[model samples]
Target: MAKLFGNLELVLIVGLVAALAIIGAFASSVVVDANSILRWLHLFFGVLWIGLLYYFNFVQVPTMPAIPAEQKGAVTGFIAPKALFYFRWAALLTVVTGLGIAQVNGYLHTAMSFTGEGAVNLIGTGMWIALVMAFNVWFIIWPNQKKALGIVETTPEQKAAAGPRAMIASRLNTLLSLPMLYCMVSANLG
Candidate 1:
């Protein structure tokens, strides 16, 4: 039991299989179905991603320059990497779950359309913005971060490029978040 629990991959696989079995059984017994569960996962992962995002933007980044140079590597090499692992994965999951929710709720097409009533158009704009942000996360940000963190080797020029790429996209996400959040919150109000 100890050995089984010790391997993270194994634990995750077991947990995932158990969760699927439970969900399968529950869905078979219930009428409402599993969309709610997907939505719940979306919300859970979104909160985790955005919460860490704000932490990095609003807290960690600002504090970094203040730390002594000798100690900086500890934060950057160790702590920051771990945080970023979760951050990127959370962001990925957030996007996946969010799209799942939209699809489950039958809003994917309309939200992508940018047509229909005022509220729908508004929601669509937000959806588009979120989609762009997610794309940036998956494409621009994650790839750059790998180089920036030495997760992948690169030239100084490439490393330099990574910083700006990641920063700009993150800032763009920050900018989009304000309006995106508003549209999402107001989505059901109408």
Candidate 2:
């Protein structure tokens, strides 16, 4: 049990199997479909991406200045890089799965165009905001983070410049996540 729990892959596989089993058992009662699965995937990836964003903002960024110079490498050299890998990929996958959900549900055009009334408009707003956030994650944040974290060859001045650029982009996403989440959740209520 300890070994199984200790390994992330095993734990995730077991969890997925358990979820599939439950869904299969309830198949007669529940209407399982592509849109449902895509929603679940989108939710999972969105949580991962936003959770990391909050962690970086609410925890890591604030704590970094306090960490002793000698101990900073532990975070910058190891923890940060791994976190960023998951952060960027989760951001990408979240957007992809969300778009899949919209497409599967036959609202892709209406939502993208912001032409539908009520829920469609709400979800469209959320989708647009999420797209912007994802763009920042991939185009702005990841590239700057790579340099800031020394994952790529860069001058000392470039690295210094990259850190703040990544931070600002991340902060922008954090700011946008609030309304985006509200739109996403509220749109489904009715």
Among all candidates shown, the one with the greatest lDDT:
2
Q: What is candidate 2's lDDT per residue for 1-190, written digit by digit as tens? A: 8999899999999999998999999999988899778888988999999999999999999999999999999999999999999999999999999889888888888988989999999999999999999999999999999999889999999999999999999999999999999999988821
**How does model 1 fare in lDDT?**
0.78
After aligning candidate 1 to the native by TM-score, how far in Å is the CA of 137 from where it should be? 1.2
* Off by more than 4 A, model 2: none
Which pairs, if any, clash in model 1?
Answer: none
Error (Å) of candidate 1 at residue 107 is: 2.4
Per-model CA lDDT versus the true structure = 0.78, 0.93
What's the C-alpha lDDT at position 63 in model 2? Answer: 100
Model 1: how far residue 24 lies from native, Å: 14
Residue-level error in angstroms, candidate 1, position 91: 2.0
Candidate 1 stretches greater than 4 Å from native: 1-32
Provide TM-scores for the models: 0.77, 0.97
**Per-residue accuracy of model 1 over 70-142 as CA lDDT, tens digit each:** 9888876897788888888887887777667767777767777865677777777877887787888788878
